[model samples]
Target chain A: MGKNNVEQMILNIPSDLKYLGAVDAAIQDLAREFSFSPDAINDVSTALVEACSNAIEHGNHFAKDKRVVVTLRFNGGDFVATVQDEGRGFDFAKALRDEAGPDPMSERGRGILIMRAFTDDLKFKCDDKGLTVELTKLRGGGGDAGQ
Target chain B: MKITQREVGSAAILDLNGKLTGGPDADAFRDVFKSLLEQNKKHIIVNLEKVSWINSTGLGILIHNYNTVRGAGGDMVVMHASERIESILYVTKLNLLFKSFNSEDEAVRSFTAAR
Candidate 1:
């Protein structure tokens, strides 16, 4: 792990959902530091963007005063992102993938499925404090991401 | 984010570029969508290749446009979506709601094809 690699930065933002771009910026900076390929960086960025949105929308329900804490860490060989929320967590097995039918008609409900598809590792942890989503994507690895 | 609109062959093609994460981008998208409705051009094709990311508000704007246009006997088609953006569209099941194309030309062609 590179010592100067940010190795960690946590930012807490209001659960307003409107401030998602702030999360996007932080992710971009962390991803770029690894010299990730344009396409690779794009994959992680897109997944993380949707993850942050779900944290605010589904987990926190856009409650303005509530907060979502995002932890970013870029080690030499791996990129890890953790989005923590104070709201209740969600069910993964019960998730739906109707967005894959093609023809581009469905208008909502697709963030988490996309996160799992793009990132190498996706997990949801729900305890008394609330929910924490940990996503891990390796740097410079072929992995299972589709182009 | 910036949404620029133009008319091509009885269709309204909105070129959406930049991040659309519900801040200024969301309102800007709404204003643009509203202007298009006022202009009476209903069949729409949105170019989202340059749009890297968006939150729920951005997706809601699409729903708003879809409802408005369909009410006017027109529908919205999406064209030239980058892969990352396409994932968002797919996960949201919007792929069924919008007709997406590999290029703007293909999307424009679909207006007549779908008919």
Candidate 2:
């Protein structure tokens, strides 16, 4: 039998930034039910929301017909999430720290940095598939080593 | 988050709860602060007793209002901050930029006292 700790869920939304609020609520509900710390839960929620925002804006180019897929996992002691887009893959390094590094006043381009700050690990995967933001965090902070 | 506005004598009190991040309140929050400033509201007190968390965007909006309020010769006071947000303020050195109090009454009273 499974340890009852490894559970996963998937959600697909209609590629709109406005859907972020709903995503936040869903993350919160799952996190709270799993007894996650408020900070950890908020961190994941914020980072995931930013990833979806970036996907809609940069990945799919905000195309009305596009769709974004988000996969959430609660495995062992870690809470992992991924956001995938249908557009051509993106440059992870550039997104992490832009060429100009982004000004504080600018609303755009800081999503990836914010995601990195909130999560223990944030990666952009490429291998002919697409741009995927892979985010991982210990629900409490054993770094996944304890997992 | 739950936001409530009430008039206290001449100033308005905005009571906030939960987290202050994105969604419906982000723009409205900034607009409310701006509208208050436009009304020549030089004194503002934000009740943060119940706020759970805030992201950089939320912090940015607060700073946006802070600069606007300061530029107009008005001061913003915060009250009853949780340790999480207080840590962020301290780390960002925003704790020095604004005055904070332990309770709602204390924060509002300081505004009246300063006037």
Candidate 3:
């Protein structure tokens, strides 16, 4: 189906971990509506968490006043979700580069990698306002991730 | 995520359930691990059989705890990881960093075996 023939949902939550449950609940509902495979649903769930975590922890810097916006669209066959933050964006590319050599002892720097692994298509955008991370996965695109 | 603790011989087994995504959930996991370190209970095995999933934040928590225990002359490993969680570890290359076992008994045995 065409991207225009899509149903969209927008949710905005404060940049707080306590609000994560609301976001995840909506995701579960969307997955069921989209008839996503169990595995696909799990992947989307994990990826969504990572995106929101990065937005709150890195993009918004845990600023309670800031908000994270999540947009979900189902184009009949594919589901796309976008996470938007209200703080200045960092160089995601640079972060990916730094995380290239996984350090067993390192305690951080794997958020983006995990996001990329569970989604079929992942994109990052930044502007003066903040950053946006988009994640997409097909209904059957449930197995063999990590890019 | 909910984390419960138990002891098997000299090893500490942390039973995890639900999603290990960070936020308040992550804080709980971190607190438990920190307390274990404080108690000098370092030979740890995180049992993930009931853990439905884990994100990057969860992986970070695991790594952080692993290093902490190792630094204290102890060790940490994972057991009963779901297929999806195992895939995450492989993609992130954490599989190379931490020892993984198919069962809690196997993981517990590794610590003594290493000694």
Model 2 vs truth, CA RMSD: 5.0
Tens-digit lDDT track of model 2 for A1-147: 132478888989877666777778888888777777877776677678778877776788778888888998888757889988888976677666553335543333445556765678888886555678898877656221110
Better by DockQ, candidate 3 or 2:
3
Query: What local distance difference test score does each model get?
Result: 0.74, 0.71, 0.82
Candidate 1 off by > 4 Å: A1-6, A96-106, A140-145, B22-40, B55-64, B67-72, B90-97, B101-106
Quality of candidate 3 docking, DockQ: 0.55
Clash totals, every prediction: 17, 0, 0
- Please give the lDDT score for candidate 2: 0.71
Error of 1 at A147 (Å): 3.6
Model 1 has fnat of 0.34
**The best candidate in terms of DockQ:** 3
Fnat per candidate, as a fraction, reads 0.34, 0.04, 0.64
What's the TM-score of chain A alone for every prediction? 0.83, 0.84, 0.88
Candidate number with greatest TM-score: 3
Flag clash pairs in model 2.
none
Better of 2 and 3 by lDDT: 3
Show where candidate 3 strays beyond 4 Å.
A1-5, A96-101, A140-147, B23-39
Error of 1 at A75 (Å): 3.5
Q: Which stretches of candidate 2 lie over 4 Å from their true place?
A: A1-5, A16-18, A32-39, A53-64, A85-114, A126-130, A139-147, B1-3, B9-11, B17-19, B22-27, B48-53, B80-102, B109-115
Task: Give the chain B TM-score for each candidate.
Answer: 0.87, 0.84, 0.94
